[model samples]
Target: MESKTTFIIKLVTFYCLCTLNLFNAIDIYHNDSLDDFLQDHAKKSIPKDPKAGKLYDVSLPSNFTGMEVSVVQLQSSSVWAQGANLSYFRVPPRIYPNPNVTWLDLVFSNLGNWSSYYYNMPNYTFVTPILGISAYGVRHAKGQNGQFTSTTTKLDLPLIRHPIMVRFPSVWLPRGKCVKFYSNGRTTITNMSLSHTCEVWGQGYFAIVARVPSTHHVWKLWVIGFGVGCVGFLLCGFVLFKIIRFVEKRKIQKMETESEKSEVLDTKYVGHSKMPCAFGIRTQPVLETDYFP
Candidate 1:
């Protein structure tokens, strides 16, 4: 029994590891690629000295223009004290990065036009672009050539003291709920805390979603088809009515011709009326019985 239990445990562990590795590989499609792009730009954009704890914009390729990318550095101590309230994001007080860090590199992304291309919410439509927040460990490593290099390594912020807030830009449409999309393919819809704000516990991509009222288009198409059918039905009825009238007139004309052909009398026009007259007496005036006496 002990041996069997140990074997089962080993099998479960191996399966879990395989699942995790496969999950990580799933990011090659977009998530991982976007991460690399953000980090690459950050390396070039981070100032040699902190700019008053202000955010610095990360430049992207021309094709990726209009998508927002910015980074801010905050000391973990300060974050634990007053909380890190940067642009569009609010981390409540006393929530430090997991695995602990001296300084946290906060990277913010707003995939404007590229939002739908990178992510999708089926059966729902996105009214706003996808917004994301990621935390990375600040690093300055000595290179082989003796030059210090700046880099950011992704860190896990597994715990939160309170709900984090994300504010999206204004959108004009039906109000929608906040949709949170996890890396592991889980999704949740949270009610809007404000008109355009959402509260979340962990980090991942998020956007506002409205229900896809598919029946609206379906009903529109049905109404159009019904109207067309009604018009066709009316045209068909009109043509049938004309045909019936023509057939009735032809029947009357045929009866009149038959009567003319079968008549044994001569029809003469007497004044304004037609008079049917018989021929002159046949075989003289033959009586029913000859009265020669």
Candidate 2:
């Protein structure tokens, strides 16, 4: 039994060692490859449909002399009657107008899902109508009143080389949101903020995301908080289990002591003849044989 237990422990240890080694072997090269892939995608830009023209208020920043906007069709399909739409702008060059604010209007006809499979539909990408421009690039604000921040720090810019598919069940854009081309021929919407500007900063694809709610911001903090909570819960459970084990051990020890005490006390039977009485009965036979005498 002892040998069996040792072998099981060794097996488990070996398995864990193997698992750790495999996990450690996971290289960051995969992420690097993905980054390279995204860069390459930016390099080989996809062209948007010529029939579709974008109309936006262009605010030429004071510094930038050469500005060009390249519309890349990310993905599109028409299972339904609605004209298929997939578009985003990619700006590769590092020429941005300001670190404070710039605003531009983006107009398009068909705008729908991007970066998804055929079953999962996409919502409008831009949350703010007024997009903020900066030295870092273009980003949308998320709040009731759009917040402004310096964009000197860089960020991961998404680059889609070809149109990626998305799934949408509904035909019309949701209420309280702006989408679709206007019949009068203008998709007019308010910009998110003045400090935040939108311009064709570089060579890649670009589209304006209008006012996004604060709740829709990045979820990194929430994810980290949940992870910490999970770790704490596991530690609490481990401590509780140890306390239960200790209590069971104490109960077992008490029961063992009582069993030992019962074995030591060899109590006599209640209704049986004693050894002295047995001997006396054998010696004293009855002398009632008068006829025989």
Candidate 3:
């Protein structure tokens, strides 16, 4: 029974130690490869009539020398469209603009269902109008379970003239689908299965490609700070340990010195003429006696 209890205590202590260490560790992702990949992606031209829905490209505007833009196409039945409908599509959120940017414009067109409404099937057609620069296009074929066409959209952005910290936009979708766009031209997309009712049905996909300003220095500084903090903490602990050891050594030395002094005093007194030795023999001087004469 005692051994069992000791084992349980050891297990609990080990678990606690592991939890502490895990909390102290930091996770960092190397974005060098991602930077190179997005850079290459920006150079590639948009392909014509890509069969799949995730076909899109990001690049600088041909006429605008100082601004950046992103061209995206969201296909029907894809992960991003599962929770998207006419209402959601009309005013799609701006997912990639930094706060420092002065202005933004979004333009979209619905290639499908426009002709049907013009040809007298008004009830069957989806009503869509340009809602300022933030309009989004939706294309749906007749009798199709998913949107059969892609909604091509363009985003116009102008950055602030001065140097400032910018918060890059991230894409959020239903079912735990999210994409993070970094200022350093790095993009990370995370997709996880979430339990929820999907509003849109079909195999569709969305692609957002942009070349935002790089913020590599910010991340580098953060990592460096974390590393410096760890080193500082370890150094402090080491110094404290040394101080404690020095204090203990001084105490031991002082005790030994006091003991040596006590022994010396005892020896000196024992050898004195008036003091008695360990055997109880007294050390006394005898006067010159008559026997000596």
Model 2 misplaced regions, further than 4 Å: 1-227, 230-234, 237-239, 243-247, 250-254, 257-293
Question: Candidate 1 on 101-170: residue-level lDDT in tens?
Answer: 7988888899888788678888888988899888888677899999998666788765456888888886
Please list the C-alpha lDDT of all candidates, in the order they appear: 0.81, 0.35, 0.35
What's model 2's TM-score? 0.21
- Residues 187-286, candidate 3, lDDT per residue (tens digit)? 3444333322111111111222222324686688888999999999999999999999999999999999998776643323645455533444477777
> Candidate order by TM-score, highest to lowest?
1, 3, 2
Q: Model 2 Cα displacement at 164 (Å)?
A: 30
Among all windows of 10 consecutive residues in model 2, the one with the lowest summed lDDT is 72-81
- Give all TM-scores, in the order shown: 0.61, 0.21, 0.22
**Candidate 3 pairs with clashing backbones:** 77-202, 77-204, 78-204, 106-133
Off by over 4 Å in 1: 1-31, 140-151, 216-293
Please say which candidate is ahead in lDDT: 1 or 2.
Answer: 1
User: Which portions of model 3 show Cα errors greater than 4 Å?
Assistant: 1-176, 179-201, 205-214, 217-219, 230-234, 237-241, 244-254, 257-281
TM-score between model 3 and native: 0.22
Candidate 1 global TM-score:
0.61
Per-residue error (Å), model 1, residue 160: 3.6
Error of 1 at 280 (Å): 80
